[model samples]
Target: MDAKTLERLLNQIAAEHLHIDTLATRNSDRLDFHEVSVWGLKEALQAAFTAGQQSKQTTQPN
Candidate 1:
């Protein structure tokens, strides 16, 4: 996909991650499960963001 499309997807993922994190924080009873999920999501987000950044850098003109 093009850089713009990739960037937009990443933004959506980030927004969803934030929403999930907020829900996790609000539900204290299932905190452990939610926290684990949030951690996994965070890792995935970081990896995606890193890949997107690398793609953008390589595609840009010097």
Candidate 2:
């Protein structure tokens, strides 16, 4: 992937992670990022990474 696209993906991942962090912070019992499961934060990130990979693969060569 190009530098710009890679940077955007990284930023998106960071924002999603921060969203999970915000959710945990809103509650009394804090949940760890590792403690998540299917359909959770990690799953969301995994899907994003997969889609990003697919997009990169399918993108036209410069």
Candidate 3:
């Protein structure tokens, strides 16, 4: 998908799995940083991958 759509999807995944407001880091500071467990990271990655796969399936022509 396009950049905007991808960003939204990533943000959604982060919010759902990591309890993050958004993945867009606005500044180089503690507030912008997060401490996430390996499991949480894995879950978010899996969600993103699933979203991409679903997007591809819908977009590809038969």
Candidate 4:
């Protein structure tokens, strides 16, 4: 797929993940609280994704 396609798909997925994470944290129970932090995971994943996008954006056209 093209960069534009991938970016659009990733943006949608990332937005969904963020929304879910916000909801999860807003009403977290003791059981879910001890589990992995959704924000941390979301942040890490977003950081990596952003880096990849930046790299792609900065690449010289062949």
Candidate 5:
């Protein structure tokens, strides 16, 4: 995927699964830092993986 599409996908996943306001991570060290449980991290990773799989499927020629 392109940069804009990837950025949107990551933001969507973070909002849905990590409760993060944004993935910019450029505000400040403290503001960018987050405290999350292992379960939440796993959920976010799974969501990202699922999105990747779906994107790959759609972009591939049959």
Candidate 6:
């Protein structure tokens, strides 16, 4: 993806992360069953962003 598109995706992910964090905080005590799922989703999003950045770096000319 181009820089603009990648940036947009990252922004969207960040927004979603914030939303999820808020939800998790609000339901922290009751979300034990879903804690793992939520954590995994956050990690996956972060990994995706990191991979995108790494790929962009590798493909760009220094």
Q: Indicate which candidate wins on TM-score.
A: 5
Output the worst ten-in-a-row residue range by lDDT, candidate 2: 18-27
TM-score of each: 0.43, 0.41, 0.85, 0.39, 0.86, 0.42
**Per-residue lDDT over 1-62 for candidate 4, one digit per residue giving the tens place of the 0 to 100 score:** 47786666655554455433332244547523534467756774886588677778878585
Q: Residue by residue across 1-62, what tens digits does model 1's lDDT show?
A: 77677667665665565433332244456642434476768776786878778878988999
Report each candidate's C-alpha RMSD, comma-separated, in the order given: 7.2, 6.4, 1.3, 8.0, 1.3, 7.4
In the range 1-62, model 5's lDDT, one tens digit per residue, is: 99999999899888878888898868797769888878888999999999889999999999
**How would you encode candidate 6's per-residue C-alpha lDDT over 3-54 as one tens digit per residue?**
8766666556544553333222454455423334666577657867787888
For lDDT, candidate 3 versus 6, the one ahead is 3
Cα lDDT, model 3, residue 57: 98
lDDT of 2 by residue, 1-62 (tens): 78777767665664565444332244344454445445556756786779677887888686
Off by over 4 Å in 2: 20-41, 60-62
Per-candidate total of colliding backbone pairs: 0, 0, 0, 0, 0, 0
**Alpha-carbon runs more than 4 Å astray in model 3:** none
lDDT of 3 by residue, 1-62 (tens): 89999889888889989988977778977768999889999999899889989999999999
Off by more than 4 A, model 4: 1-35
**Any runs in candidate 1 off by more than 4 Å, and if so which?**
1-36
Off by over 4 Å in 5: none
Ranking by TM-score: 5, 3, 1, 6, 2, 4
Whole-model lDDT, candidate 2? 0.60
Candidate models: Cα lDDT each: 0.62, 0.60, 0.89, 0.58, 0.89, 0.60
